[model samples]
Target: MDPKTALPLNTSRNMPILGLGTWQLKDDTAGTIAAALELGYRLIDTAVDYGTQPGIGEGIRRSGVERSDFYLVTKVEETDDAYEATRAYLGELGLDYADLMLIHRPPSSGPGEDLWRGLIKAKEDGLTRDIGVSNYSTDRIDRLIDATGEVPAVNQIEWSPFGYSDDMLRYGREKNMVIQAYSPLTRGKRLDDTTLGEIAGKHGKSPAQVLIRWNLQRGTAAVPKANQRAHLEENIDVFDFELSEDDMARLDGLNERFSSLGRLPYA
Candidate 1:
């Protein structure tokens, strides 16, 4: 797959198939983002909860890239007022509008019915161009649609070959929603798998590259976080080789429902 490929949203916009995720980035957030931008990364994924919005804004200023050229994604937590929180997030990012905003997770008390409304409101007010959800099960998403009469444009999830789910993939395809994959590298935990090693060796690629290629071939947007120059380069260098059907099948079978976040099944 081409590294420049973009996945269509339910809306008119298209999200870059690969993006830079800022979760634990701290003091180096601005430098890392600036470097990633220099490497031609056009999509940036962050959240108010990550406390990296300020750095992201600073990085964008330092990159000298045009705002319209790149995609910006941020999120509102389940506990916060989605609309107001979205406004605050924009203020932090020093942007007037975000390309996309997502509800960080399902609410503890409800199926995110109220939170969904807030996100929709933000979109209606032009605070965001598109809105979606993160860490939401299919059932919860259905309920949101039922309650708000709107389909989320994307669903961010903790997904990797080891944590694969056919049902989730099918759900995204059926809904015409992009599944933004976080931690596609397994956070450096499962890189030692013998099967993954074999596949990587056969293709003359690293295990991390193999994993990222798997996600890209499946059409899921993989946002692997990397602050170092080497990792930043390695993460986005998956466009050179293609994995065969057999290779994909082997990787798919590696799924043991593994999730570092202890996520439950997408019932």
Candidate 2:
């Protein structure tokens, strides 16, 4: 039940399901990233918009861990120069290539297909090992496939028991795209929910752990963030426990079609 064990990313390799989310995590980036690496987290998610790449880089350097041992992911923010910008940023981060690179969000100002072309190029040129989209809708996904003739390797979305989207998940699965759940803890809104609390009580765990376990059971990879050392440790501790089928059903019943952000056309 070691969390470091990577799950099947298809048959060729595995990806660690539980990862460290780097949103709004900066200033103490090196220290925090180093600490998390020391704590046994192999997957780290960051983005250009987060303004923490330098810190992440510093952390990685300080951690003294070999780059090949970690699954490093970053994103290209929606900007006029997304491709070049991402390349420059990664240069600053001092990594030759990222394990995964995503389109941070559907561009609001330009052709998403054009931006995707840049991502495809990055993948082809080996700047990124895998390229994908984030915050994309099913329609957007279809258009992307039509343009690129290849589905994204991963589609990161906001998924939680509170706001489950079976349609999106099903579509991503059909395409062999990994469904990565961001904000899987519901941004602290559902930590005190009666049902989640009940499940936590039964398992002697926290509500956050219950939610993460639910995501793992559903076969979705999750990146849950926590700045506190204790909280970070607690987040990855779910691998040792397995929820019962009945408990899984009860948690599944808690889906309310809720969304922290109003339903946007894109993810």
Candidate 3:
């Protein structure tokens, strides 16, 4: 349960299990990131569309932490050339290469075989240490593998106990793709639910901590967004205790495909 604990990738690299998700993080991005890094958070998630890339670069500089000490993930728009987009994102991040790069979504017309190929080339040229996809179905990933013969190192999705299903975990285990869980805290939308409240009261933990711990115990990476100091500390302080079998089963039963981002296409 160490803060820096990570899961392995198909590319033989380790991706941190817990991270800071910067979905709409724009104001004071540098300050928030700098604080997180100093507090032992090593994995950071952002996207080109988030417009926080420059701020992230500045945060890393402000933290006085070595660039290699943390894992950075960014996404490319599915329309642009993945390789060029990766290069451009690198510049915006002020880093030579990102730890991981992802296709933000699958192509509208097809499975994005060509875009996947571009990511393969980017990995070869070291624009990113590993390549992945976000918001992709398992079937779409299969098509990418069939066309390129390369499996994605990670598949990020909006996953939480409320939106849970065993399908993605089974496929991820079968293919060695880490399922990075975004919005693992449910965006604070369902934190006040009675079930979550009961569980939190039993464990003497906040509902948010329970949600994150569930992700970690299930073996997928969790990324919960937070900019405030108290919230950040609470998010990372989930390692001291473990949820029991009953707790896990009850949590699993709460799944109803809930998602603040609307219905996920994942199956």
Candidate 4:
């Protein structure tokens, strides 16, 4: 549960287990990111659809932290051309290279194999150091590997004590993929759960801290977003304590396959 803990990627890169998610931090995106960096967040997650890449890049520069010290993650939308989109993302961020790039989701009309190829090509061209996917089921990931003969380095999914599956965790381990958890706090939907509150009370930590610790304890990376300085500090402060096995089981029992993004069942 070390704050500086990083999981090894199949791509030979390491991703910090905890990061700042810039989903709705559209306004003052740069300022938010810069603040997160100052507060000790080494990983910053953004996406093409989030429309925060410009600010993200600017924030990184403003932080005065060398680009190599941070893990920068961005994604390509399903509608955009993967290769071209990767180029566009680099351009928008004004970065010569990205630490990681992901396919935001599968396109509605075409097979994702094409998009997977586009990501692979981006890696081949050195546009990004690592490549992965988001919102893709294990079967879809397998199909991409079968078609491209290349495995994804990570799978970004909506994972929390209430929404994740043991099967997905096993699948990720078997495939050597790092499962990055988005909405690890369940978007504040389950923060007030009695079980979570009890656990947080026991550790003298906030419910959000308990949830973030659960993600790390399960061996997945988490990206929790915060706009306020207090929240930014609170979110990354889960590294100091450990959740017991009994508490972990209690939290695991709360799972109902709930998706914060409204994608119930998450199949």
- Between candidates 1 and 2, name the one with more favorable TM-score: 1
Supply the global lDDT for candidate 1.
Answer: 0.89
The per-residue C-alpha lDDT of model 3 at residue 189 equals 94
Question: For residues 1-267, could you state the per-residue lDDT of candidate 1 as single tens digits?
Answer: 565689989888889999988988775999999999999888999998788999999999999999887899999987898899999999999999999999888878867888889889999999999999988889889999998789999999999989967888999999998998888888889999999999999999899999989999899999998877898899889898999999999999999888867763453
Error of 1 at 82 (Å): 0.5
Please report the candidate that would top TM-score against the real structure.
3
Worst 10 residues of 4 by lDDT: 258-267
Best by lDDT: 3
Assess candidate 4 and give its lDDT.
0.88
Over 4 Å off in model 3, which ranges?
none
- Model 3: colliding residue pairs: none
Residue-wise C-alpha lDDT for candidate 3, range 5-124, written one tens digit per residue: 999998779999999999877769999999999999999999999999999999999999997899999998979899999999999999999999898999898889888898889999
The predictions' CA RMSDs to the true structure, in order, are 1.2, 1.9, 0.8, 1.2
Candidate 4 runs further than 4 Å off: 264-266
TM-scores vs. true structure, each candidate: 0.97, 0.94, 0.98, 0.97
> After aligning candidate 2 to the native by TM-score, how far in Å is the CA of 6 from where it should be?
2.9
Candidate 1, residue 116: Cα displacement in angstroms equals 1.1
Ranked candidates, highest lDDT first: 3, 1, 4, 2
Which residue pairs come into collision in candidate 1? none
Cα deviation in Å at residue 214, candidate 4? 0.4
